[model samples]
Target chain A: MKTLADLKKIREKAQEEMKLRGGNVRIKIVVGMGTSGIAMGAREVMKTFLEEISNRNLTDVLVTQTGEKGLSSMEPVVDLIEDGKPKVTYGNMTSDKVKKVVVEHIVNGRVVSDYVVATGN
Target chain B: MSLKRIDLLICCGSGCVSSGALKIKERFHEVLQEKGLVNEINIIETGCMGPCDYGPVMVIYPEGIFYKKVTPEDVEEIVSDHFIKGRPVARLMLQDEEEKTFSTQKEVPFYQKQVKVALANCGYIDPESIDEYIATGGYEALGTVLTTMSPQDAIEVIKKSGLRGRGGGGFPTYLKWQMVHDNQAEEKYIICNGDEGDPGAFMDRSLLEGDPHRILEGMMISAFAMGATSGFFYIRAEYPLAIKRIKHAIAQAKELGLMGRSIFGSKFSFDAEVRTGAGAFVCGEETALINSIEGQRGNPTPKPPYPAVQGLWGKPTVVNNVETYGNIPTIFLKGADWFASMGTETSKGTKVFALTGDIRNTGLVEVPMGITLREMIFDVGGGMSGGHKFKAVQLGGPSGGCLTTQHLDVPVDYESLKERGAMMGSGGVIVMNDEKCMVNVAKFFMDFCVDESCGKCSPCRIGLKQMLDILTRIDSGYGKEGDIEELQRLGEAISKLSLCGLGQSAPNPVLSTIRFFREEYESHIRDKSCATKVCLDLMHFHIDKNRCIGCSLCAKKCPVSCISGSRDEKYTINQLPCVKCGNCMDVCPVKAVTKVPGMHPEVAAKRLAETKLSHNYDE
Candidate 1:
């Protein structure tokens, strides 16, 4: 804080901490948290994705929650979105399925097509 | 460690805080905790988002959804639906006059044309946190100036930037810095003039409260550029929140060694103290402000030994407005040419305007210089409120003139506004509607000037009083034939002979109204009428018998029992007992009650007939 180097260091650290508030990111994971989705364990699935992302220190990936995807049968749904890549929607997601999706799709840039229910956008 | 998903930036500015923003923030924390999503959703209390008409505003980031007028009760729904469920509340979004809803802050028409140079970090970052400010590139300019640029080099950059004093005078900022720097004083001082006393003006207050560090950074940069060792922030006592935040910013900067001895580990050192003015409008003038800060009476002394040469206990001082300081950091960070490329030929950079009165968006807006009054009022301001037509706009404050509809297209640069009889005095633009009487408007500002006059000089002390008396007479319908001419004469004298800016511009509202709306004053003198019915003495309450349905609503609602007659005969206003409160006019169910301008209906009719249609009733 006393020098230019110190100020730049703090700014860089703060920029990292504030990265979630920024709009541009490499990957976005959307978890359905509507009344029906939450009742079907979507909250646990969202929490799992959050913990996995944080543990990996993936600054480029953002895990968020959404209301409904209009697919009640696939209540615990998760959408993987990356710029220039087609959106991948995984249906009936469980807490155990989050790490595999994060490792393969988020880290390795490969979709877990087994859990994928639909893909578009 | 859970990855945060949403950032709910709730506005905790003074306006929103008064409108229960704190309670809503508390409710958000409670609801997020109840939903066990507290770690995932970050609720940050940010500064003023400008459009205060939609106070208790919250902007959800990542999606950039802006929710306005959010209540404590709405917080739970916002957290559940938007935070967890990710469905933004449509009803809480910003709705325009056409009922068109804008979901994002970027899409709102109020912010469309506004270029935020001074207010860039106002609504975006946390004002209390030095880290948030630094992350947004706050003190980098000060650091850069201290490490690399010499005083002359930094001053040259500012000079090339074309920065002027935003405190209404439009003085060259670099000239003041250079003058202060050139003076061979050991203890030169930099002062931030935060005593914004203009009615409906909170641009300075918002800048101080929202981005205290930016203003501090600005002051420090100027202090560095001018070789100033000490500085003072002369904020008005009316803005307690601004005072607290600025003090907090000073403490944080000192703690981090961004201020005090050898700032940023350089040879230059600077420190600033926050001084609160006693809410005297005259103290906003530079000399008067320096007097108040130096423990003397807030009376202005004569110029020639200006503050740059002899100021703040007889040392070289550079006093700048809050917005002026707010722009200094950006000029260095973004480079001078970038700053100079934005504004007009003479006036450069953006000017922050506190838009109030009949405008739809009653808040702060930072627009580039040379933006037309029509764009400011109609486009950025969202036009006149309550379906009213724009009559005139009172620019500056009590010291500024009124520009009518004819001047709407005039570019609002410093020289352009001065040419149109109004100086950009602190950028307080009070928009008036057609219902507002021009004479009453002038009288309002004149009364303000008369009350705020420091009484040190005769022209300001006695002349403004005489002008106020004339305006009062005109407003109360006792205006005479030669009164307008006398007012113009006194106004010119006051402008030429007054001691400070206060007295010099005291007669502006009166003189400008006389200049533009001369016919309105003539009507008040000759016909004894107020076209807008604002002069209660000239307008009489009349009940149209044809429209009266004998409902007795007006009679019952009349506070003074002025309206008589029962349901059988239909009600009529007893003009003798009527106090002209217009209660009957408001309460009339059948539109029976109306204001008949100038004397009684019969007398007006008789005068009209006797004049043989010689007089023009067309306004």
Candidate 2:
């Protein structure tokens, strides 16, 4: 019951995702999924980012997970790696903030300085 | 001219995965694609990178930039700046004790002192992935044994490793293997004792859950050495996660032609199965464990024709605890001398202990044999919680003894611990602070043993109950001068006559406490005083008028309403009405409620001082 076009579409999508790796306007988002981070709601925060990116059709942003290395007092951590700027790590993020990050930071090319862990200050 | 690719390593250890590491991985992919950087970044999930204190952590390679406390919101900036511009995030980096910035994880003090051997693959490899484990040189020893070395050769390698059982008995592992090997039985069995019943212990659970394949590999190697055709993992039903992971690992290994038959096309064929325990504490004993596997009551049986001689279904069997089995593949992989050279001469290799109680870092620790108690408590355990004064440390769970500050210098090995009136009982080290009452602690352990006794032996069943009653009476200010002597006599009798290890070691806590802190017992008996103010009946709560604010908080909160007086004035506790519940003491905002000996403080103090001074003379 399946068509070759569907298979071709799947292959094309995979190829497209593979091809977007080296774009200049790319955005990288890293979420902390360590035990403490997950206990503090990192799962919801991560799902929100994926939903927002897909809904907004933003293809320039990449998301990933990282391990815990101490600082257990604060978890559900997020690190933003923007082009042409210093990386910033944030903590205690929520779903709404993930939306703002996708729209304002990824699409508009502006670092939401308030939520940034390090503004290089 | 060049294409850029960033590798994001995520921790998927239980501690991290439960914190949402998997979702974080998904979010990373979504955000990367949305920002058009999906192709440039490769997200990989790794394992536990110790320093569990700052867990849910990830480190960026190439630059070796370390980040802490990262959330979803911060992910965007990390992507925008670091991966895009290559400028490291300074604020996200870890800070030292002096608040100095540390960019790399190697600079962290918590990691610098640690020498990891048992936990080598804990955080670095994907535990669930077989390829990662194989890439990291897993199962090479099993391959070597099946392909090159004979079963006898494998046994010799184990003997040469000087690997004693890590299950606290200090029994040489290879000897046990050889005993089972020499036994003439057609259906010999090997069992991994995963029923870790010691309180505050999770070393077994973590190893089984984190790296099931390693344990499986070890079991396979052990089976080969002992000529065991089949093995059973006797894990307590309490560890659902460990059971699930191990079952999965076994199934996968079977599918890969490694477990069922003719592994790697060798003449030998072996398989494994899991048997769930009903969570009986006594099942940790080999005899009790074997009995439980037979679908019978888990009661300890007399030894001599031990499990190695006649075991499950009347066949020769070899049994090793979780930590002992975990050390097996490593011994075979690294060779004998490498494993032998790490610890003391008598007890070689590391021992994983669950450091709990008053320690600041309440978690699992694997330290080499012969490490002093002082070093374990201070350097590794991060000292007492809340910086309280260190008083004593109880080793080996209920069957173990408590060591005071005087014994801090004693090296922790099987022989040393036993010589100090304590056995290395499943490696549970519970640190106690100055606030603890040694006598009360002994009573607590005695109570636990009394409840857990299988009642098969009359001496243990009756003697422990009698000792508990005496301890309870002494702690309640009703003990006479002869009670201590009676308890000691009964403890000795029970210890000498008990049938199995469980019954034999039931009185260890009481005996050890009496040997070390006899004055504490004497105070309760001779002076009718609880020095630590733990026994409610032996303490009298009085309000110091100077410190009392007369807020009426104590009077209002008292269940018996024993506290009487006006709010404008000071409060007085009616002695007759006071139930000694300590509710007034807890509710007092100021340090007004003072606990003094019910008899007399000066008399109690004098008696305590006399007893302390005469202790050495008496001994």
Candidate 3:
């Protein structure tokens, strides 16, 4: 990936992998690490995302961390950014729920609406 | 990992998150796991999918089944009925008046009507991964240009595309690039302006947060076109997410060898850095943005050299807006003719608008330039929320204009909008319902402008203050007859005599509202009231004797003890003690409370016709 051609080659390989994974299934999991987020068990939720992405061998999934988004009500939250335009924020994410999220959300692409703290842009 | 056949994409836009999308997601997990359908279905969470009002929205793959407003209680029903029985819960889908559901995503009127260009990859790509962006054919245009087209030829392609700045005022993209390119200097710089500062606008933030690679690619293309050594992405500090995404994107681009020295092994070598804004709305303006980027106070200098000749520490710099830069690669990838084909004669390509405020389908919508405001509201926005009649659409934030019902059918091109006293500054169309008072809306924007004013010039500083005072008086029912004329006179002076774009366009909201809804202002001045009942000082709560049951409910709940008379007698409102907070209205179980506004009789009639009053005596 040190050259332009390498960049193109990898992109082509990624496209092939995308086809293997059904072409349109790139997902991002964000764990809130803000003051309220950490106080309300956000660190465990963060660990869950990293563990699950690796365990599942999901090539397209990305796990990131963030601080308090000022919305204190939905603490210990995780935002699932898939496809982009719409971001779904799930609140009070326990370690127990992470497995189910991995199976249904990451694998199945089913939205866990009960925990949806934030919905649109 | 092996993939599942079914995918459930949930909308996680701001509207949906606030609407409890997280709870809905958790409910889906519980139901799916319990039903033993967890392995069979895959759930993916995405960003705002246009119809934010209907969030937490989700679409099931294979069938493209659309669901909206999915509560935790309803998730069980959806999983059972839709996943197990292969029958979608018809109630969850967006339905017409006939109770028929629009099951498919395309069938939903909101998604079908939009033309996604700058947003072509947004809401449909993984923003963090450069691979996903590349797989979607992202950076191919940059690659192709670096290997094939000359810098001069690249500029020519952009010029031919007829692309204009989407930040507002609709400046030509190619001309800016050309100016920087033609300017002889030891060094030149190119930039992506991501400082989105409009009140109700989130288009730029959405673009940056959703698809950062697109913006980076756009900047890279500009760097190649203008022969610049470096570029910067000036994102607002308030948008931490956007800033992070851009930072990630630049790193990824560099790692992939798409950025840094001798890109693609060509002589054209360019790089970019991320510089965050310090929460100033005026930084959206090019000159002010540059100042902010250089660690100076964000202030706009007069533009004669125009940054193209001398900018960014005395170098020719081309600062294309975030949305404007997003269009650069699209024009190069698709032919200029193709990019030019979608929009009107002057305004080419699609424009992304943060469609929100009192509108049903409140989200980011990308539409061709010539689309009508009527279609934006009825078709794209899914009509006004809460059964409120459409009053006006505030375009281009405070610096823009308020377009009324009369301008509904008019094409939303840059020139067309400018002709009607509105400039297509940043495309942020905030829908106003019948309940929204026009004078108050103008005053709100005026207040925003006055607070944000740099105070470098007396015209904007002193002039805007005078206007705000006048509007405040009128709204509070203390307006004199000559206030309207005074506002118009002062508003004109501010627009004319102010320095920079901020001051020059400071009175646009007031000026445009006065132009379209002059009668609303007239009613506020001549009658000493607001017809919309929004101005608290201009209205009084009255006990409707016909509806009052003498339950003493109104008297019991009056925090100010404004109500008089016994339980068996007609309760009268004492004007002296009344704070007008309407606590009596909240506690009255028999529906006795009502309002009497101060406005013209005819204007009151018109307002009543538009507002379907329904008071739920529940706090």
Using DockQ as the measure, what is the rank order of every candidate, best first?
A: 1, 3, 2
lDDT of 1 by residue, A1-121 (tens): 6678899988877776666667348988888888899889998898888898889988777777788778999889988888888889999899888889989888888888899999996
DockQ value of candidate 3: 0.11
Instruction: State the lDDT of candidate 2 residue by residue for A1-121, as single tens digits.
Output: 0222332444344333433323333667777766677678876787687667767766666665565635466566788877677777766688877778777777887767666554431
Q: How well does each candidate superpose onto the true structure, as a TM-score?
A: 0.95, 0.76, 0.81
Which wins on DockQ, candidate 1 or candidate 3?
A: 1
Q: What share of the true interface contacts does each candidate keep?
A: 0.70, 0.00, 0.25
> Highest DockQ: which candidate?
1
Q: List CA RMSD, all candidates.
A: 4.1, 11.3, 13.2
lDDT order of candidates, top first: 1, 3, 2
TM-score of chain B of each: 0.95, 0.88, 0.92
lDDT digits (tens) for residues B279-357 of candidate 3: 8888888888888888888888887868998889979998888888788777887899999898898888888988888
TM-score of candidate 3 chain B vs. the reference:
0.92
| Predictions in order: lDDT | 0.88, 0.77, 0.80
Alpha-carbon shift of residue B372 in model 2 (angstroms): 1.3
**Native-referenced DockQ of model 1:** 0.63
The segments of candidate 3 whose C-alpha lies over 4 angstroms from its true place after superposition are A2-8, A20-121, B22-43, B72-89, B599-619
